[model samples]
Target: MIFDCLLTADAAWLGGRELAGPTAIGVREGEIGWIGPLPAAPDATHREHIEGVLLPGLIDYHVHAALIQPEKLLAAGVTTVMDLGWAPAEIWPLVERARHDPGLPRIHAAGPFLTAPGGYPSRQPWAPPLVAIEVDDPAAARRAVEALVAHRPATIKITLNSQAGPVVDDATLHAIVRAADAHGIPVTAHTQGSGQTRRAQLAGVRVLAHTPWTEILDDRLIADLARDTTIISTIDIHGWGEPSPDREIALQNLRRFHSAGGVVRYGTDLGNGPLPLGVNTREIAALTEAGLSPTEVLDAITGAPLRPGAPADVSVVPGDPIANPAVLGQAGAVLKGGQNVTDSDGGG
Candidate 1:
């Protein structure tokens, strides 16, 4: 069959992790249809030979779509993003837009922050009123989960930031986890303050929106977190391109977490500070500093393979990103669902 677009690259990040010699990837109907060595005589409706590393589009495990436009992410080779929190009314439209527009990074969002009344983000001036759904009890927590499930959130977001304000009680947190589990959705928590990380782990939170930074986690607690939860690395958000106590503590905690075999996903908490709209090299560098090997860091950003039937998203960089993770921030070309989102003349 004639492919819609055929991309030939000097090297392809096979399955988004392993690098393979000269390769060609064919896209059909917005999905990968084939991948193999480039043909000596190519045959396709459209063909582009790229002299760079071709990889599956990167996935930023945490972001706030309302805070940044999709074009910025696409240009940075990020084809998919998981938005942790926003009002359902505000975020759903963006998710819907992603469905119809390949130019936008595919967005999977948690509708709003499920928290106790007057908790965390609700008290933050930047957050809108509807961004936090205040659930006071187990019943209210379950109902809130149900309401969020109706919007088909990628996961349920619960706020457990005692340092900021009132946190959801243990019982209510468990109820939210149980309700989310019943619906086959995982629960991620924004854990803060003393013992909040332990509480989230014990309550069965599957992911932490940010690495716990208020206090250095004990080895035993770190082990528990490693066994039970994946932590989204938003360490850079604590520093915002500058060094501070929070950044140091978060880096220390994350290093311990990584040493204990914890799963770390790439994220920047983009909207919380004056962070770049695209892939933050600082976030990548921070992950490396936290003890992630070069390959592991790439795996965190790539997330999955670019196999047949997967979304036709690809990022071509001028050089090997595994050698210098920062190179990822400057993509030479980016494609989402077989369509070119950005391309630079000099192979940026």
Candidate 2:
């Protein structure tokens, strides 16, 4: 039997500082087929009166899938996540499984770190085998990216942690960016230690895995980065929930960048520490501290709106997140791709 599902909520957050009151949203074949005011809604085969503020599914811009259970993330309103660092051979299978399984959040992956022979993750004990490909020169860097094209990485990532062993040279970094551009892939970078953020930005890196925390950024440099790149906010990872100098430094840097019209994406460096499994309210609180208004914060976490033709991934929270940003902590009910995922305990 073919049936369409309708969900009615007291209010809905439509992103970009817009909110609609008393809404009716319908889903057909895993996509939003209809949406309007509750009084004007058409009949559906099944109707549910969800009792909460409705919003689009949240997205975690960075995570490592291998470290946690996928279902937990979906259960907590994180309908999508990006696997920023993992071997293509290992992460690709997980990505394929998530495409058809409601049990997992939709996955976007960047295969491995393109780094200098003895760079960052290569020496970190926690990084898995094959998690990084070392390149000695520009030719090797380009070739490594070309190889990843077959596996279809969502984007290319480079490591420039000068404090931890060697950094990828400028020629090699530019080669990585050029090759990724040839294939229409954007490049993300993890910058650490002194001057690395400036180096990454100058090299055409479109995304920063973590906001620069080691040193304060100059006004001109921060302005340029705001104009050219998107920064992933992994603010709480520096101290988990505790306050630290690094956390304070990053928050200040982000504060200025945001005021300068920078783009910030919410990404907890999940799996790096004892961070929250689902939506990290700590990260939310940190972003609030970094000067993002509740409305701007909503745009950062839930990158899209709950409109027609959008995937029917709904979030039912306690109150309007814009009014009370922390309400995103526990979604009372969630819909993933038009399916009411909260119906069960989400068991295997």
lDDT of 2 by residue, 1-348 (tens): 233988898899876665789999878888998887999887789998999988999999999987888788898989999988887677989999989888788998998888899897887988878899999899999899999898788989899999998998999999999999999999999999999999988989999999899999999999999998999999999889999999999999999999999999999978788998999999999899999999988989998778899899987898878878899887878889888787855712
Report residue 338 deviation for candidate 1 (angstroms). Answer: 0.9
lDDT by candidate, in order shown: 0.86, 0.89
lDDT of 1 by residue, 170-287 (tens): 9999999999999999999998899998999999998999988899999999999888789999988886879989899999989998899989999988777788988899999999
Error of 2 at 225 (Å): 0.8
Runs in model 2 deviating more than 4 A are: 1-3, 16-18, 345-348
Show the lowest summed lDDT stretch of 10 residues, model 1: 339-348
How well does candidate 2 score on lDDT at residue 174? 95
Question: Backbone collision count in every prediction?
Answer: 0, 0
| Candidate 1 Cα errors over 4 Å, as ranges | 15-18, 39-43, 343-348
What's the TM for model 2? 0.96
Candidate 2 backbone overlaps, count:
0
> Which residue pairs of candidate 1 clash?
none
